[model samples]
Target: MAHAAPRSGRLTPGKRDRKPDTDGSPRVSTDVFSERTHLVVRWVLPVLAGLVVGYWAAANRRSGGPVTGWNLLFGFTTALAFMVLCVAVRVAASRMKRELHALTWAVFLGGTFGFVYAQTDKTALRSAVMAAAVGAVVFAVLFYRYYTHEDAEGHRVP
Candidate 1:
């Protein structure tokens, strides 16, 4: 069988090879800012939430209920639960690169907290609810920015 000449047209022009950098290794870009921000939310938001709860107990749980101490204890416990839930969601969202979703969840949780506070006639709980609501809003905005930044960087969130 006769061999045909190599077809130069099959080869495309401007082919570039991407090699490892000067350290003789491959470096992957992992956006740590989002992770760090999420970490902050995990710890900071919960503590703030706990404070809000304590303040709520001090103000509202102080009256109109037998065993004022017990009332305050319950209020604090509820707030701590909220904090735990929020931290869990924050971690999940950060991993998924969907902070907005987490923030939305936080807002909903704040409202749930508010309902309990209002229903129980606790001023401190009410105050806590208000603070958490405000924080949720801020977190939502920050998370939106974080997601946007990640998208621009061509990160595949999926």
Candidate 2:
């Protein structure tokens, strides 16, 4: 009789082999943890980042202002709005199969930040100028990164 094959309890290999591909990069991981990490990075992290940005915006606006229920309301509402914007951008980029124009989004965020900051009895012009300058730098860096890392189809270049 022919010998039976051994049944090892280990997981099966993925579509790609363990060896490096033509680009000298390892194959994408199919591990369960890796998948979970990807999900968190893709979805949860963006929301969390939005929350942080919103909180900062609200706090900046509230500085030296009245301490009332309105403060709480403003903070919560701003956080919700920011989170929604982030999710929208992510969805749109995914559907379009292209990298989101970080510069445009950065300008939007900076304008939001400046508007909020200007509400705290500060000079609106100064606040806007500062925000725009920072936004420009952010735009430049993100543009370079996205351009280099993604192809025209917006697919990541491994």
Cα deviation of 66, candidate 1, in Å: 9.4
Candidate 1 has what TM-score? 0.45
lDDT of 1 by residue, 37-98 (tens): 76677589778976686556545655655656666677777677767766676566556545
Alpha-carbon deviation at 92 in model 1, angstroms? 1.9
Could you tell me the lDDT of residue 143 within candidate 1?
69
Q: Candidate 2: which pairs clash?
A: none
TM-score of 2: 0.68
